[model samples]
Target: MRAHRIALWLAVGQLACSPGRARTSSSPEPAAPVVVPAPTRETPRAIEPPPTVTVVSPPAAVEPTTPQVDATLIEGPAAPAPASPAQHARLLDSPEDPEPKLRGGIVKELEDVSYIVGNEWSLDAFREVITGLGGGYVGVGPDQAYLMMGWQRPEFAWLIDYDPKVMRVHAMYHALLRHCGSRKEFLAAFEPEATDAIAEVLDDAVADDRVRRLYRNNRDMFRWRLRSIERKLARRRVPSWLTDDETYVFVRELVLGGRVRALRVNLLDDLGMVGIGDAARELGVVVRVVYVSNAEEYWEQYAPQFERNLAALPSDARSLLLRTRLVWQVNRDYVYNAQPLQDFLAWLAAPGVETLEDVVGPKPPAQRDRINFVLTTARPP
Candidate 1:
């Protein structure tokens, strides 16, 4: 019994002497250590501070890296819109005239082009005479009217033609000028290969189906017309809207402002010219320049309606009538003449003055083979 008691005492001593089981009765127990997770390879060291041994939350789930892209580059460029007539109205003092109806002629096919690009090679000569006469302009034909308008800088311009096709031509001009960014862009829109592209632009921009159809059907003719004008102007060394960027911008702004209108007007018609005159008078705008373009030669006698049409137009002392006649005596295609508006009216009023021949009595003796301007005197007081 004594040996067993001694063995139990040795066992108790061994247990109490164990290093991990050692304890002091007067000391308190030590606290447990906090657990902190180590950062992964995915964690961005520059953006986050290093994790400490202290208690903390796990890092938020890392978002996948994405490539940034511009929205415009993804969607591509947007197409342009048509010119706003509302914007145009804000620039004008008077309201627009009511839309005029077709009065005289309708051309059916491209082959029927009487004056797509006129043969007035000498129109540049009139620039000096017409410049600075900036009221309202009434003219016939297409490019020549624009050339004269560019020179004169009219406040408002009426492109009146007997043929409806000419108005269609003007609509094409409106579309091209309104949408094209620069002179190069303008010329390129008229290229033969650009037919479908320009048709698309016109389709988007022009509201008139007739205008679009005319352009699509007669692409070759219109292209040829523009190219011919470019070549002609280049050959003549004339600084025109097509050839000059500044002039093109000037004319383009005018078209964009809605100051230009195309109408089907016949000089001898009872209603069309009379309506135009009434519109001008209502607007309080004078017709400073009237370009008849050989239409006077068509009549042998002064039709009373034609006389009334001329008389009806509001004019000032500076107002003039521009006409062209093929004087074979002068070696050019036409002799350009400017007659004072009042004098032309007086000649039409005179009983003996029957024809255009009586008004422009004779060709100049000295002028030959060159563009010449014949300035008619004012009516005798």
Candidate 2:
């Protein structure tokens, strides 16, 4: 397999260099040099709420369903704790081994900016299942990540996506979360009237040139998406990080404390996925929940590396895997699915388990909020 990959990569390199093909700016840029910023303290601006609005108190934290397992320290010299948010962000980058290249022709070749907001429609369905299983998080996409991370209050979060544009939007999210004190202020920054505020925040918080440039270029679209998210959360009456003060503060602290990291990492990549597992282990953080957001729909069969990556994550009996599938037979949008990590691994290991449909079945439960399922069995936990 190693020899075959080397030969294939050599062929790709020849093609890349031999042609007169002009590369487009839409392609993901090469990794940037690490620059840790000096830590500075600033009190967030406090904003008052409207007279009619009522704030919901965040629920008390819940104990893990199972006992926590301590991570056995990696047998090597230990690194000192990171001093700043930038330093922590640097830790989440792809590891040096396996060279961090993507599969499937740059791993999902489409580079257009993502739906900066999610289309999942019913993330609230996951609130009870995922809440308070705090450890570390690995997931894809934009706002949906924040929602799950907020509910779980994970010790750290790595928002991994194949698209660099998605990473740029997440960069913007980090900056906005860092600067905005109140939920009102955070959502307001996405409005046209807050251009100056947004500029100040972006200029100070985001250091990567490519991330800042791309984000500014598509600010309008992002602003629209974020505002739409707030409207949807309100219309649904779902208490979220945007709608609740306590949830907002928790997510804000994760960002400000430098525990939230967003990066481009393909799930099937040997480097990034393994790197996430190793990083989590070194930090002594269990990956309690992983939200893939319908990414499985893109592939018909699981790659060998996919199995390896899932195994590498340090999980316990209580650990959960969350995904959404557009089972049109149930709802026009998506049906949220959650499974115990152990059960999911068992299903993946079973013979003839080729795709999501093989595991989740041809149709989801008619009551869309359901979670547990066997290869052909669906049941409520």
Candidate 3:
């Protein structure tokens, strides 16, 4: 595999230099020495709320661990902890791995952001819908945060993925933003700084609490995350815009002023670590939107757990579950695809539908299909 990759890369390199083929902005030639701004103490302006008026509470003290939910953690007067940028930086010091509650309680599979370069054509549509629905989002998947960057403009974004490597990737991003001020310097230093010997990186960050803890306990995890990011870049995941320092600053500025965060949270957590409802209440805002991607398509068998998770999230009439759909599964007739589905479900919950066997088969769509499926609490239960 290594040899094959080397040969393929060599071919690509040759193509880049081979001829007088005029390159577009998407494909650039050699890079020039770009001067990225040094880390600045620039205070970011407060992000204004979206059309639907989403909100979150003030920043609180960063917690040191993800202890399993207890009485004090779950229903207390203290609102759910905001997934602040500074709060995530605190995870850099986690002494051990934070584990997601798995079904079998066994490690059967492990991977995140597999360096796959493909047509993520739905990203534009996802961004459009979420932006239209307004903000306050928590999503599941690796790097989907990048997908929602410009448009979603969320008040709070929780980028949750199942894989530890995925969370580590996010952590590396956290470290970068905490350290670098502008794009050019970030592009130059991110890999080198994060991937260096743990001791060396720690020396510069001696005063940072998160940095010190990361150096002490979670150094190996940080190294793997840095390596994964570099691999993704080699596979061309890094966009051309990020290459230009000016554009980098421009894009980053448009994204929330350090309000987003990345973390390891499962959709099936019994107590709900990615507590959308809890956070919303704590932040004094409604969680108007959520992006589950196609997770439901593959994990629908765990519906009981997933349903409980959703029920726990604080939602209202305006809230919507943004999901995709498979073409084959969509019903052309019912149109319960919108409000009626919830009504039909409410009916089924009562005892009257027991005699009707016809309602058992054909159903709603999956989120990954050409026409994605969305869920809303349009009908009063």
Please give the clash total of every predicted structure, in order: 0, 0, 9
For 1-381, candidate 2 gives per-residue lDDT tens digits of 323433332232210001011124655332111111122242212121111111111111111122122212212211123326544745555463331333232123321213344545556556656767888888876667888876777887888766554666688888877788898888777666777667766877777655555555445545554565567566555556777777787788777776777766777778777888888887788999987776676576887788788889999977888876543223223445577776677777878777766655553333322322211122222
- For model 3, the local distance difference test gives 0.37
**If both were scored by TM-score, which would come out higher, candidate 1 or candidate 3?**
1
Error of 1 at 119 (Å): 2.0
- Rank order by lDDT, top first? 1, 2, 3
TM-score per candidate, chains pooled? 0.67, 0.69, 0.47
Evaluate model 3: give its TM-score. Answer: 0.47
Pairs that collide, model 1: none
Model 3 Cα displacement at 357 (Å)? 16
Better of 1 and 2 by TM-score: 2
Model 1 over residues 99-201: C-alpha lDDT tens digits? 2242221111211223444545556656656776777788887567777876677767777766555656788888899889677898888676888888888
Give Cα distance to truth, residue 86, candidate 1, Å.
10
Candidate 1 lDDT for residue 352: 75
